[model samples]
Target: MSTWRIRLSLFLNFFVFAILLNTVGIVIKRVIDDYGVSEAMAASLEAYKDLSIAVGSFFLASYIPRFGYRRSMLVALLAVTIASMGVAVITGFWITPVLYMTIGVSFALIKGAVYSTVGLITRDQGEHTSLMNLLEGIFQVGALAGPLFFSVVMGLHFSWNQTYWIVALLSALAYLLLLITPLDESEVQSHPEQAGLVEMLKLLRWPLVWVFVLCAWLYVMIEQSFGTWLPTFHERIFGLDKHIAAGMLSVYAGSIALSRFVMSYLSRRIPWLPTQLTMLGGAFVLIVSILLTTAGWQGTTVDSWVAVPPLAWVFSMMGFFIGAIYPTIISIVLNKLEKPRHAAMTGLIIIFSALGGTTGSFVVGFISRSFSTHDAFYFPLIPITLLALMLIPYKRLADRFHPASPGG
Candidate 1:
């Protein structure tokens, strides 16, 4: 298969993966509530998905080059298709956890394989950043639209559980795309004898890797907290109408996608540290402004929008500025590792990245539940602070890893 064809397939597959992931958080909530599972236990379903991804990535890290990216993604798509259909068929609350765990497993493969493949297809930072940025923006579109798509379906037909079938069909179509598209063999894994997990760990002995993982994990929690739950937060605390609350999330994610599109070009001019630090610091101001202006967004009604609240604007700004940081982190990861070790390192990076996704609900849930929901917004500040502090070090390290691309 042609390399461009493979790249297209990868982008489409990744977009499909994004929708499934973002939608599930909204989907399972109704099912779990109806099942009468406590909020915390029901929420743990997502954590299981992350845990599975982390474990799967860890174990499967070494062999992806052997199986190949297309095959790994294909297998992951099939798993998701089956899991989505299973949720539609099953009635017992007992099975929801299993299906979610299965999703975690599938997503682990697709994400680990897909993210690393970005490095494989492109030549250097500029081309890679542009492609990753464009693709990630579309993923955010899917994220923004997926929940609303389900919302419309549930609204029109009141068939909440039935929503899984549509996702199943989409997954099956993506599976077919994988089957038909050609794949490039991953350079990281072409060898007959690749580094084993133990050997992989020797490379990971660098403290920098763990630091990056923590940064990835924390940023996810922050973004997902507002992205996934911001609507609810607005609905409950600010007395914003439901429609407006939902739109609030749109503005946030839309901004994220937009920023990345620009960062695709912007990265060419400014260094990553300065760029990241500026965005992070800006986000810090927004977060504090958000918390201070609203009297606390705990129980705002969904139907009533009493003019756009000031904090709603903060969420929108956060989304746009936060966009490139993720792909930036991945770029840094790819640059840091030598070619032979890239596949294994990519897997662990993806695992923590996935963990960050899973951490979204737990962080929000526990923080909001233990303290006031309004206070929960402050939780993300801790990681944002850490990421900002690391900016100088990250830059110094990034220089050794990725010297500037030669001048035009």
Candidate 2:
């Protein structure tokens, strides 16, 4: 009923969504071994989910204001709840694409609605960034739990399909919680421009929007590549057991949550754009160093701290830096626009992020399938470097357009 209650409900819903979203990564090896699909085939699952999100968001985003964020979220929750059940009941590898597609489309609605609502609730860019970071931090905690939870379910003699039932139950609970809460769309400020397909197209006219789009795309690409493929990389490169490999991914996911938690506070003191560029630089150097070092190591083992390359530690911990980029950029973009455009811009944000995710998974999968997983690490280096470079121009644009709250 109250504002905080709605925000709380959103956090819970996003947490549930995060688990289901990350499952593709956790289950990739299982899909490969169970279904006999190649690495590329398993990797294409990202495309199914992300492209669905992209297409769905592109088409459905403008309608959020008309349908109301609350109603759209209700539909999204119910849809995903049913879809998760479908995942459990459905049999065989052929169902995988359908399962991912259902989740992707449902999430498109949920994300467009929730992000739009956030812009409504927060008073200014500072609060917006903080709340966004906190919400995403909760999502990362769910991601951190995903692989470990999947491994636990598998170890208990449960089928991987059973994981969907957990998602189903969580969604059901989130749906019920939201059912009772009140959301006031009128409290939100409306954009001066008319709300429709035309207005959505008009947003692309701004050069700043393009920069944010590319930045969002690059960040998600890197995030998904690591999120979707890290388990397979560990298992394939190091010969670790599935459970161990999956558990290792928690490091990456956990760092995201931890870093954002830190950023929610650091945002109060540190300048955002400068800090972000420095972190990206560190990430580029770390990833390149890992690739070179990994090539020289004859055999891979997860046996001991001393045995493994420092890459694993640095790579997993890279999430600390990467975590703040997305939410911060989202805040930056939304802050630049009027209230009416927030919903559509959020959709565009999802669109590029989804496209980037699809491209990242496909590229990494193709490279890993054709060459080695180690070599696939080279792919992200370009994006990382480019992201840092793009930020220089983006900072100028933000300062020029929003002088009062330049970094917020």
Candidate 3:
């Protein structure tokens, strides 16, 4: 198939997969209502999904090149399709943990392959980052649409489980599309000397890899915290109905998608440092705003949803900045590594990102329990600060080792 055909296939694949991956925020509310789980218990679902992704990535990272990207993604799509169908058919929400575990494992396979495939297609750093932004933008589109889709189904009085049926069908279609698109995996660089378990582990010894890993972990933590809990946050703080709460979550995802779409264009015109630093600065401002608004909510009474704090909008819209960090970091990391180790490095990225997602969700739940839901909003500030500080080192390391010149 043509290059554009391949990109289209991968784009659609991510679009559908995102709906499954980003459903945690809505599911948090569903499990609470349907299964009568506590807030912490409901939040534990993220650990199930993310920990499984980490484990799957660890086992499959070194072997993805041998398995071939196209084959691995097909299997991943099949696995998620089956799992979603099972979840839809199962009664009650007791099957939730198992369902998420299945989704997590499937995502690990798809992501490891997908990240590696980007390196194969792009000719240089600029192309790589732009493409990553485009793909992530598409993924956010799915994230944006997912909550709205959930709200519609629930508003129509359908059982929440029926939502998985939509996921299953979309995943199955993505599978067929990928199957038809031919991928030239033979073009992906491989080194016979660095194609095994020891070689992959050796990547961990590099300080730069650890830096990228930390960056990935922290970025995902912020992204998933909002993605997984924003709906509940709105519902609780604003006293919004289930559909409205979920719809507001879509607004957040939509902001991220919109920003990413803009970044896909702007990244080509602006230098990487300026574009990234500007987004981080925006995040710092918005997060501080969110913290201030939530802290001062003590004497307020919400007589109607309209009386709810507008900071809730800031909390959701912060995705504009949060969206760029992860993909931009992955793009930079991929540019730094030799192509031979791209698959292995991509696995590490997913592993740390999984770790971040797991930790962020749990921490938010813990803080909410210990203090209040508003207090949990403060947890992201820690990573946001660390992420901003780390960029200095990341830039220095990048310039020293991987100059923007082609084949650096």
TM-score of each: 0.84, 0.85, 0.84
Global lDDT for candidate 1? 0.72
The TM-score between candidate 3 and the true structure equals 0.84
Query: What are the root-mean-square deviations of the candidates from the true structure over C-alphas?
Result: 4.4, 4.0, 3.9
**For candidate 1, which ten residues in a row score worst on lDDT?**
399-408
Residue 105 C-alpha lDDT in model 1: 74
Model 3 agreement with the true structure over 1-408: per-residue lDDT tens digits: 357877887898898778887888679888898878899999889789878888887887767777778998999899888888988898766688888888888787787788878887888877888888889999988876776678799999998889888888989988998888888876553454555556678787766777778888888888878877887777776566666676677778888877777777777677877777778788878877767766645534344556556776667788898787677778888878776577788778777777788789889988988998777877888888888888778877776765224333
* 1-408: candidate 2 lDDT, tens digit per residue: 359789988998899888878778656778898778899989889788877887778888766777778888899899888877887888677788887887788788788788888887888777888888888899888876676677788999989888888888989999998999888777443533445567677788777888889999889899888877887876666666666666677788888898788777777677888889887887788777776776755555565545554556666787887888888888888877766677788788887886898789889999998988878878888788888888888878876774234232
In order of listing, the candidates' clash counts read 15, 1, 0
List, residue by residue over 212-248, the lDDT tens digit for candidate 1. Answer: 6777787777777777677777777777777787777
Worst 10 residues of 3 by lDDT: 399-408
Question: Once model 3 is optimally superposed onto the true structure by TM-score, how far is the C-alpha of residue 230 displaced, in angstroms?
Answer: 4.7
Instruction: Report lDDT per candidate.
Output: 0.72, 0.80, 0.79
Quality of model 2 by C-alpha lDDT: 0.80
